[model samples]
Target: MPPPPPTHADPPVLVIRPDSARTLGLAGDLWAFRDLLWSLADRDLRLRYRQTALGVAWVLLQPVLGALIFTFVFGVVAGLPSDGVPYFLFTFASLAGWALFAGILTRASGSLVQNSPLIAKVWFPRAVLPASTLPAALIDFLIALLLLGGMMAWAEVAPGIAILTVPLWVLALAMLALGLGLIGSALMVSYRDVQHILPVGVQLLLYASPVAYSASNVPERFLALYYLNPLAPLLEGLRASLLGTPMPPTNTIVWGATVALGTFVLGAAVFRRLERRFADVI
Candidate 1:
């Protein structure tokens, strides 16, 4: 018998074409490969701690060290307000949450370039590269939260009904980080400048955000502009709810949430729109 012709019934067809289509359909595309999210996240986590002595202990130590520095500079020396909680407790709690966002953003921003070999060889959603960073970052967030809980207990800060909504505020921050990450990751594929600027930008954002300080620190004249950062109201509300301080006005919180949602949608669209060129550029 002569050579048999190769045949595959309903073979998967991935048509790589230049995209002008700006659609929110990236969700469906990414959802199809959800398993890869976990796999990639696990692989990344293992690689991160591969040869490290402390391994996961770094998670607890990282925020603790940062908090100690902030406690001395902002809490002890500067005598910043902690909304009635111990300044160490206040700064540490906020730093825990802020770390989640910053960590995710940093991972996601460089995901494409770091995984360029896989991007070129494998057929998968590029978005997975960034989305996978979330799990590892979230794991760190949970560990850090345990530290925060201990701090809260030490301070005798009993949370109220507002604490129940902490997840909502977290989701809001995650959405914003993902949105920013997608934009940065996509841009980095073609423009290397984004990679260079991202670190400085994130550092500036940390100060702009209410991580080490309270929202009330901003002068009245700048309150409106400050809340425009979206994280301002969310962080303030979170700190208040967790530490039993007063939450920001309900209107500001609602507006911040709305902005968060919009950012997510915008980021997704931008990522998908530019996703087609990733293989060529990366």
Candidate 2:
């Protein structure tokens, strides 16, 4: 009588289980997206060079122009001592590291907003966007390094075994840029004000850093507090490694590495946490 006893068959049961979200394995995710990362990097490279008249020449031009200006301002006008090294070579060497940091930070900070459509449409690890910028930055840094090499040769300042440590210093710079850039990327997504403020902040940071002069120029009384700025040791270490200047103390290197690593980890954590909301918000 009641639906013919349901035809003596059992009704379909919907088995609902708790939706256990899989935790992201950072290493695994990065590995999985390696190809995508390379593609994105290639795309960025092409876009950067597509319509530009100078193409890759822009890379060398930036540091060269920066060196010339700095030479005029700091070397000729201010008469800042380069610790006996030629002022042009000294400032250019420092610019090698500074440019890399600045370029990567600038690109990475704007990566999210620039790729808004991709962020909204695709479902990939957002970390790849910011990380992709490093390869191009590295390429530019290498070009600047070649110029630095020529300057050193002209100056007759041959490098020593300390040059072997150059890669480690570069790694430090990459970490610092990526870390700060990631934080900027996440913050820029929510607060558009960051888009306006970041450039000014980076400019202030450049003057605060010792790019235009030597770290030794900082008064000894403020040395302790000055080194607290992580870039101080990084720029100094790069110069020492490449040009035979005294290396930053071991403690400074350790502190710089600690700060860089901490910043990167914190940035990554924040990026991952905010990523889910990126599509909806952007």
Candidate 3:
């Protein structure tokens, strides 16, 4: 007798569709894959210090060392004002926030390309990649914050009631970072130039913001335009809250919040528009 006819069953089908044609339940999908988000975040945390002798100390060292350098160069040599707080504290406070924002932006911009193999083989919310970078940045931020607390205690300088608003300012910075990261990551799938441009942009932003000096130092004529950098007011507000310096005006904080929200929405829209082509191009 001849061999029996081979059994055949239809293979499972995953009908991939363009983002425009598909209604993506982004929130739901992200919620469902919450485990993956943390997993990727954990992976990032591990990989960050995997083989380093200093381990997590690098996080503390960076802002601390930078603060010292800036204190000497800008504060001592240049006689820059520090908003009434010690220059070291002033620079450290701003550096902590800057590190968080820069870490998220840098890690997220490269996330998609770094995980190109996984992306090509799997199907999950691509947003998760950029989102995952945030946890690591937050962890670094918290570590840096602890060091700042110690420094403040040693200096006998206590945070005021405004310190309670620290988390809110952190949230605002995260929003801006994640938004820009999304835009950069999406664009990176097509343009490698973004990778080169981002570091330069970040460096420029470092000088542009009130990191090494006081926002108050900006000339009266240019102060308004300086605060236009969104990160400016947020950083100033955060430093004020931490170091008990003067708070930014209510209007400025409101403006910063609005700009952060707008940037986040714009980033999501840009990412969605380009996400469909990511797998094909990346």
Candidate 4:
């Protein structure tokens, strides 16, 4: 027995290693874990409907309710113009885009904290948490769009060639929401105040955005600063797409996309940098 013990292999190298240096290759990592992303997203969609009687109908309901209120206030009382489009149709179109962007940002910002347990135990890429909300929000957007189509048909307003730009406009909105969401989610782990403030912040943003009114309402002098709000071009573009109103100038849309991309990049970098601390802090 003693002689057999002496023939053992090299002490099973107990290499004490520090955490492997993880570079946040967001695109590469995200592509690699596409299945995880889909799973998380499906979970979110399911949770969104869990225990709810109306289920996904809530998606169609939200924008419609908001549109009714805004139409009464802005159209009936304030007498805002809808650029020859019916006020109901005009407001509904704008609501579809605004709701999607705002909903994505709101849900995404809270995604990390909401899934704290998963974050603590999982070795998956953290970005997937926030990105998962996008698809659910996009589903809500499409459902709302169906309602918008009904409104359009009722009003007999046919979307022209300008409608082709809707995809580009939606891409810009998604980028903007992702950037804001990433920043919010990162900040939220360390500072819980963000959770309380996000709803109020989004509420204020709704009025500031051209969801109820038109960008044309802004005086020429303020147009420069007005366009600075990324939602400005997106909401306007949506309205134009549905109602054939004037599109945000190409330059403005380009500038908005640039800002959106910049925000997303900055947010991703900050999120990755802060993510190492999340498990400990959250």
Q: Each candidate's lDDT (Cα)?
A: 0.84, 0.85, 0.87, 0.85
Cα lDDT for residue 11, model 3? 25
The best candidate by lDDT is 3
Cα misplacement distance, residue 201 of candidate 2 (Å)? 1.2
Q: Report the lDDT tens digits of candidate 4 across residue range 180-247.
A: 99999999998999999999999999888988888988899999889988889878987898779988
Sorting all predicted structures by TM-score, with the top scorer first, yields 3, 1, 2, 4
Question: lDDT per residue, candidate 2, 1-282, as tens digits?
Answer: 445544212235534344422244554565668888889899998888889999878877889999999999999999998867888888999998998899889899999999999999987778888988989999888888888998899889988899998898899889889989998998988898998899998899898887888878989998888889899899989988888877777898899888988888888877777777788888
Q: TM-score, each model? A: 0.91, 0.90, 0.91, 0.90
Least well predicted 10-residue stretch by lDDT in candidate 2: 7-16
lDDT of 1: 0.84
RMSD of 1: 3.8
- Deviation from native of the Cα of residue 85 in model 2, angstroms: 1.2
Give the higher-TM-score candidate: 1 or 3. Answer: 3
Which candidate wins on TM-score?
Answer: 3
Better of 3 and 4 by TM-score: 3
Model 1 C-alpha lDDT per residue in residues 1-282, reported as the tens digit of each score: 986654322135535445534232577556767788889999998998879999878888999999999999988888888778888878887887788888888889999999899988886778989999999988888887888888788778888888888898889989988998999899888888888899998899899989888987889999888888888888887777677777887889999899888988999889987887788778
Better of 1 and 3 by lDDT: 3
- Per-residue error for 260 in candidate 2, Å, reads 0.7
The sequence of per-residue lDDT tens digits that candidate 3 reaches over residues 22-60 is 343555556767889999999988888889999877877
Evaluate model 3: give its lDDT: 0.87
